[model samples]
Target: MKKTRKLIYLLEDNDDIREIIAFLLTEQNYDVCAYPTVKSFNEDIVLGKPDMFVLDVMLTDGNGIDVCDSLKSNQKTHHIPILMMSANTQMFTVKEKCDAEDFISKPFDIDDFVKRIHHYMD
Candidate 1:
């Protein structure tokens, strides 16, 4: 039987980072829906929830920690694993504020990043 690809929703404001992350996840055989802003993410999330969420800490339109908290609080999406990424905020600060499954600082190691995503997905 063929294995089903896991779906991942990533919210990042940087165009290049969004593309790179999406590319990396896709290469790992995951389906990725990447959004550039909270507004865009909100619009797409209503359609369906992904198996996991990768969110940035600071956004141009909104805060990623706020988004993670909302997702963790909601019944429909609370169970999905969230990995918070931020260059501006401290990892401990993000952890204290939200219930993300994991946290990664900006300029993260590629091996560690993939390992974290696999830890949740696999």
Candidate 2:
């Protein structure tokens, strides 16, 4: 039997950032399903659950904190690891509000980013 790739649901509003992260994760051999808006992500999430979630703190339509809260509260998706990313200086407050497994500051090192992802994945 063929091994299945881990699916990651990524929500980042910035076009460049979304593309870059998606590309980086793909190159690392993980399957990524990226979305720019919360509405779009919400629509697709009902179809399937990802092995992990990488959410941006600030979004064009919605904030990732609330998304994180919703997912954590839901019985179906509560167990999946969520990694929150932000360039915001107030991430400490953001971190306290959500139940994500990990938090990473933006402008993060590429090597460190991959390592964090693998930490939860493996």
Candidate 3:
């Protein structure tokens, strides 16, 4: 039997950031489904549940905090680990308000980012 790759749902509005994150996660041997906005993420979530989520705090259509809240509240997806990304200094407060398992500050170190993702997976 072939081993399945872990699927990660990523929601980032910045084109470059989304691309870079996709590339990085792919190189690390995980499957990544990236979206440009919360709207797209919402559309995909119903199709299947990802192993984990990486959500941007500020989205073009909606904020990630609410997304996190919804996912956590839902019985189907409540157990999935969420990594909230933000440039905001008060990200800890935001994380506390939601159900994110961890957080990544913007302009984050790529090495550290991978580490955090692994932390969630493990």
Q: TM-score for all predictions?
A: 0.97, 0.97, 0.96
- Candidate 3 lDDT tens digits, 55-84: 999998999999999999999999999999
Which 10 residues in a row give candidate 1 its minimum summed lDDT?
Answer: 85-94
RMSD for each of the candidates: 0.9, 0.7, 0.8
Error of 2 at 68 (Å): 0.2
Candidates' lDDT values, in order?
Answer: 0.94, 0.95, 0.93
- Top candidate on lDDT is 2
lDDT pick, better of 1 and 2: 2
From the highest lDDT down, the ranking of the candidates is: 2, 1, 3
1 against 2, candidate with superior TM-score:
2
**62-113: candidate 1 lDDT, tens digit per residue:** 9999999999999999999999999964788789999999999898898899
* lDDT (C-alpha) at residue 64 in model 1: 96
**Model 1 TM-score, 2 decimals:** 0.97
The superposed Cα distance between candidate 1 and the true structure at residue 98, in angstroms, equals 0.5
